[model samples]
Target: MSRCVLLRCAAAAAVVAATLVAAACGGDDTPTDVVLVTHDSFAVSKAVKQAFERESGLTLRILQGGDANEVLNRSLLTAGDPQGDVVFGIDDSVLSRAVGGDLLEEYRSPELSTVEPDFANPDPHVTPIDHGEVCLNVDRRWFASRHVPPPKTLADLILDRYRNLLVVENPATSSPGLAFLLATVATYGDPGWQTYWRGLRANGVRVVDGWEEAYTQQFSGASGSPGKRPIVVSYASSPAAEVIFASKPLATAPTAAVEEGCYRQVEYAGVLRGAHNEDGARKLIDFMLSERFQADVPGSMFVYPVRAGVPLPEAFAKHAIVPRDPLQLPAAQVDANRDRWVARWTEIVVR
Candidate 1:
């Protein structure tokens, strides 16, 4: 889910940029504030924010740059002169764009050693921060009441019995949507994936602009919303969010993730190229990897921290399902095919 947020373009005079360069080159003193530009889904706890500020002696300013795609696109437009010191939420699906554009400074946080080995990036410009799985979430109660079995895999989605029961976000506009699209691509080869999508279109799958609409307004599984569709494309951790945010104690979550066809999405943070506060930016990246921030990640953003051995929240531990074998596509393959795939997908499914 993303809301359009205005990004302030960096348009300072060359003299001003040179002054910043001089300050960065001659600095022992950290800047008073460090800006973090991230997607709308980014969140942090007040305690963690305060702790980082106290420890680093700098204020952390976060700017929401719509969704992951928007954030990346905006950063590319201002590559050498970024709008913020640090850019967060560059995920595996679109990482090559950031790296290829030279939008980030090369400064691998020492904290990278603490990250899970699977998420380690060979690219030196960014450090992994958090990860999540995008998969189908079914309304358990909806199927139970109707005496119908819930869908368990991508192959089941196009069955006649489940017709018109699923809602998905548009891949061109949403991160989870794009992940789901990539999952299909990984599951089925290029042409085969197109065939599967044709089946989905024939079976009456509905599409929305983003996750918020599909999950909150169209998907019956979501908490406290009267949505008609029984299944939605959303995060594997969404079930935990339901349990954690429930109005009253419930025995179990109403929704559950379908492990098959799940896609792993690992997000990263980097120091923007030519930032005014390079030292502060690096410290902020370190703070994100620290246990204090990592511990708060699950509850705040419904995603798992990349830092190894950080304890999960009780609700998340009990409800969120980590896929045994989540699908993945090489960053290079995805970067090369993303636009073509999205366009082809639109023609087949949307148009």
Candidate 2:
């Protein structure tokens, strides 16, 4: 299947109401089922689910809460009285909010020893599962066809030649959008970041509500609905995904990531406070960090595993570009300034 088709199918699945699938018996009142609350983008193989069910003996129920911010907000609203036993896909940009809301119980996974120390945060309440770069993905054919060199850096997007050729999601609504916004903040610093956004706005940068629209609708590399914009704010792993999910085997990906100024987004999963199935939640977290799940991550969700020594799929090994100096902000700093920065971004870029 093509990337477009797969994404459409995933999106369809995300929109459907949450469902319950009962697991094997673990006695009457011991809570044999655990609910996992996550953003719409989460995906894993059936084998992984089966393994978890077979080993932990807990039925996994998933609740997809729109997007990352929406997931965080929903989890926050039900913090102590959580609707789900576990919460996943909370990225560094919003981790502090989850921490501040007191939504998670402090439980360190033993699997942490296997995770790369750089990806590990000091917080015991959350465990890193996967990480990916939010960067500019360019349709190589589009640029080559136009005889225009693809922009290599974030600042290059504002150049006159690249004007009206870029589409980005809204920082207020999307995780990658917020990560890109923070990238600018980290790249340019306070007032300078505001100036950079103004430049982008003046250069006719297109903004959408989410990644789905930006990648599937407005991106020129999309299968059927080809668009004018060649540069999109998307994951560094996206090109590898394109290669892996192509309708036919190809020599190379049609798209590639612009490495400079990319922002790293690390996703973490945690046991929710007051969960009915605390043991099950902790088991789920450990399972996420296990070699089986880590190996499944690249092809399944198109994100690099946090656990070291997990082999990358061939497509990822060849096509994905891990940024040498990806932009980053401390979780506390991001938490402190996220709202103000997003609001300022709206004032400068959206309004």
TM-score of each: 0.91, 0.91
lDDT of 2 by residue, 256-303 (tens): 999998999989999999998899999999999999999999888898
- Candidate 2 — what's its lDDT? 0.88
Lowest summed lDDT across 10 adjacent residues in model 1 is found at 1-10
Pairs with backbone N, CA or C atoms under 3 Å apart (clashes), candidate 1: none
Candidate with maximal lDDT: 1
Q: Evaluate model 1: give its lDDT.
A: 0.90
Q: Stretches of candidate 2 above 4 Å error?
A: 1-27
